[model samples]
Target: MRLNAAPRLPWMLGLAGLIPFVATAAATWLAPIAWQVVAIRAFLGYAAVILSFLGGVQWGVAMCRERPGETPFRARMLLAMVPSLLAWPALLLHPLTGAWVLVAGFVLVRFHECSRDGRTQLPDWYQSLRTLLTLVVLACHGLVIWRLAGA
Candidate 1:
């Protein structure tokens, strides 16, 4: 699916959302030593929020696609909640550990969405956009992890 087919508003908003992740990741390296921890924390927090937001997206999709009592509906709803569950606890862990957790959450959510049944329910352009965004988000997480390790 071509990203050009996606609505302009959603596509632009999604790309704009990357600013926080990019800025925080860059700040980890560019900020003074005393402020690096602050940058890391902000990065972690933003990651958690985005992760949770992904879950909410899933939940919205499930609600729209599935009937209340269907077997797949229950499963989809349960799966939709997983990202938030992973993200909330991650906030309390060390920044390095939290980043790792967020990375895993993003990967798992994207993986699920790429499943055969998952693809059938969502628009092709959305999946394409998600793939692009997830790759960039993971790269930002990698940068933060590398910075943390070297500190």
Candidate 2:
């Protein structure tokens, strides 16, 4: 395929990356309630889902005028996020592991593309900040999951 033809790279990559994350996320929910990992997973899962939606919108707007030949980054990004929405409700049974898997893949696509284009590279501290936020979000979700599982 032509270099440009692979423009859907971000969506594909994000989906691939999200698989393991989804698996891990599911485990958090599956873990014996005493493990208390479910809350954290739920929160991360939620944030990841929401952020991906917003990110997709941004990506779509950025490529708004690109010709039909050009890949609609935003559109595909938005499409990639669809799974996340579906996954949220699936949390009922591990919520949306499949959806989160897609989210991870989409994110990977963005991360790789950004690095490849030499455009925007998140700073080390920023990455750290994300990690911290992710942890906190995951913790919160775990609490929610715990409560749900108990009911």
Candidate 3:
């Protein structure tokens, strides 16, 4: 997909979202063993924050739909809250558990936005962007998990 397309803003923002994941993951790899826990905690915390932000975005999109009748107001509202709900507990848990929860949340949210059984959906370019972001985030989390396993 063209980078300069109408979805450029979201695409750029989505890519920018990787900064925290990459930075923390890199730090976890490079930092001393004693500092690794701190780095992982930061990574998971950042993931939870971003996940919450994404949920808000979903809520906004649903609320501002061009066709309000496409999805019932209550359903859209409930669906929109899912990410934040997931993210909150994630932050409270251990790093490993929180990372997994965020990863699952990302995958589920992407599916909710892109699937044919669409209630509230994103534009094609945006969906594609979300797919890319979700994959990268999941990979980063996988690395975190793997490192934790080997620790």
Give me the displacement of residue 97 in model 1, in angstroms. Answer: 1.0
Residue-by-residue lDDT tens digits, candidate 3, 19-137:
98988888788899878888898888888888888888777876876357655555666777999999989988877778788889988887777766433455657766766778888
lDDT of 1 by residue, 19-136 (tens): 9999999999998988888999999999999999998887887899878888778878899899999999999998788889999999999989899766757877898788878988
For the record, the alpha-carbon RMSD of candidate 3 to the native fold, in angstroms, is: 2.3
| RMSD in angstroms between candidate 2 and the native structure over all alpha carbons | 11.4
Cα lDDT computed for each candidate against the true fold: 0.89, 0.46, 0.78
Clashes of each: 0, 24, 0
Winner on TM-score (1 vs 3): 1
Give the TM-scores of the predictions, in the order they appear.
0.95, 0.34, 0.86
Candidates 2 and 3: which is better by lDDT?
3
Worst 10 residues of 1 by lDDT: 116-125
Q: How far is candidate 1 from the true structure (C-alpha RMSD, Å)?
A: 1.2
Candidate 1 wrongly placed segments (more than 4 Å): none
